[model samples]
Target: MPLNFAHRGSLTEAPENTLPAFQKAIEHGAKAIELDVQLTKDNHLVVSHDHKFTRFNKNVTGLIKDYTWDEVRQIDVGSAFSEEFAGTNLPTLEDVLDICPHHLFLNIEIKNIPVIYDGIEQRLLDTLSHYNRTENVIVSSFDHVALKNVQNINPDIDLGMLFYYRMLNPWDYAANSGLAIRSLHPNQVYVNQTFVQESKRHGYEVYPFTVNDVNRYAELVDFGVDGVFSNEPGVFGS
Candidate 1:
């Protein structure tokens, strides 16, 4: 069976990317969790999926980079999801590091596109080093340049490239990209049996994103994908 990564930390059970969601993922038996990281105005590393607060907080308007950590934390990120979770605050990357068990695999996607954070790769590496979480973690990004920066800073740190669109011979692309990539993460729609096999044949692990349907999950497993990102973590017993 392929590993199932809790997308945004068991997002169905709690507000996405909040501390409650992450804890719920652990309780739901998720061994792997994928979350997004963005830099705050004060340079604090925060856990959030959207650059703007529109999805989570209608009262708050602006990009995450527009506010300091203190201001970001003050906004209620959970009320939009549920009244029970009202007042739930956004969590910092360090906050997640403090809560999540060391044994769990972390796929931290850097939300750096459209609004790039200067030197975010190095800052992320520094934060991981401080938490002693230098291993068992894959830092992914849609911005290949940011990923290259990560590789330049620490070649030992594993890098995963995130792609939304289907590409021709992605494994060959990765091989020629000059970065020692650890894995490939594509939108689940683009994944196929040949894609999985070809990627693995080229010595790369394949993990597709945001797969919530059970039948689709089974199909991906049958296709020989290494893992999948899902909102329902416990559904596949991962």
Candidate 2:
């Protein structure tokens, strides 16, 4: 059966990338979880989807990189979603690592584009190492340069290439990129049976993003995808 990766930890239920959302995902039978990570001004590794807090915080409208971890944590990232999660704060990478079971798989997507964070790859590796959570974790990014930086720092860490556009031969692109990619995270609309088959043939897993529809999930399973990133975690578990 294909794995069900809770996108931003069952984001449909709680504020994305928060501790509560991750807990909800586990309760909803998600064996894997996908999250976005960014660097704060104080060099803290924060778990957030957007570079700016405007989406989550009404009082604050600035980039995450401009604020320290202290400032970032104070913002109520959950209230926008609902009152029940009013006090929910942005979680650090370490914070998320604390709650995750060793058996749970993690797909950590580095958000480094538009505002690059220097030495983020090394810091991420260090944190994972400190917590002994390197295993069963695949670090992915849309920034190929950041992925390459990760590879140069640690060859053992698995990397996933994330792209939205359709590629004629992604497997070839992966092979040519010179990075040992573990998976291909493409937009669900760009995925097909041939894409899945070819990716598997090249020894790379295919995990399409944000698939919430039940029929689409079944179709992807039929296409032989390794898994899917979904907000509705319960819908994909078979």
Candidate 3:
């Protein structure tokens, strides 16, 4: 069966990317979880989707890269999602790793697009090395250059390429890039049986993103995607 990953840990069930959401995803029976990460100004790895905080907090307007960990924690990220989750705070990558189930897989996406964080790959790798969990994680990014840096730094760490649009036979590109992409995370709109088969035939796993519809979920399975990044794991994974 395809691995069913909770996208940002069931964003519809709890605050996206928060610890509670990840926990809820576990409760929902997800064997894998995909989360976003970016370095804070102090170089601490923080879990958040956007560089800007305005989406989660109306009063706060700043980039996550511009704030320290202490400053980033001051905002209530969960209240925007629900009243019951009012005090929920953003989690660090270490925080999530500490709480994640040992049996589960983690897809830690590097949010290096638009705002490149120099030395982020090394810092991330160092942190993973400290925990000795590099084998259980897949580091992915939209920025292929940053991905290359990650590959150069640690050839053992698995890497995935995240892209939304067509790039002239993506599987071929990944196969020929010398980066040795273990997986390809493409937008759900462009996935089909041919794409999935071609990808696997070339030794790349196809994990399409943000699939929520039950019917579409069935289609993806029939199309033979290795896995899907889903907002509701219980709905699709079940």
Candidate 4:
């Protein structure tokens, strides 16, 4: 069977990336937990999908880059969802990693690899070294150069390149890089049997993004794409 990733840690029943979400994934027997990473002003790598904190606080509209880790921690990441989730916190990658046992692997997405997070590749390496999990990690990105940089830092760890839309030929880029494009994160609308066949034919795995509909989830699985990234992983599992 293709790997079943607990997208953002069983996010259907929990606030995405919260400890609750990750715990739910582990309990549900997911093999790996994938997450997004952003850097705080204090050089902390937080596991949030988007860099803006505004979703948590309407009045909070500044770039996360503008705040220190301490400042960012004071806000309520969960209350934005519901009062029940009010105390749910934004977690540092290290915070979550320490609690993860030997059974799990971390798929870390480098969300936007611009100058702000320039030294981030090295930082992630250092953090992974602390846990001795460099071998257990997979670094991925939409930015090919950043993926290349990550590969440069640690060639052995698996790397995946994310795609948003279909192009004339997507695998061409991944092949040119000399990087094994294990997965492609294309939009769900663009995924069909033809795309899946082409991806596999090219030796690439297809796992499209942000798909939550149960019927559509099954449709993709039937199409033979490897897996999916969803805000509601539990729904598909059903």
Scored by CA lDDT, what does every candidate get? Answer: 0.91, 0.91, 0.88, 0.77
Q: Is candidate 2 or candidate 3 better by lDDT?
A: 2
Worst lDDT run of 10 residues, candidate 1, spans 229-238
Q: Write the per-residue lDDT of candidate 3 for residues 1-238, one digit (tens) a residue.
A: 8887888887887899999999989888888999999999899999988888778888887789989999888779889998989978899999999989678889999999889999999999998898888887899999998889999999999998998887678988998888979999999988989999999899899899888888888899898888888897655356
Ranking by lDDT: 2, 1, 3, 4
lDDT of 3: 0.88
RMSD of each: 1.0, 1.0, 1.1, 2.1
* Candidate closer to the true structure by TM-score (higher is better), 1 or 4: 1
Measured on C-alpha atoms, candidate 4 has an lDDT of 0.77
Clashing pairs in 3: none
TM-score of 1: 0.97
lDDT of prediction 2: 0.91
> What is the lDDT for 10 in model 4?
75
lDDT of 4 by residue, 90-154 (tens): 88888889778866767789887453477778788788888888876678888877787777887
- Looking at model 2, the pairs that clash are none
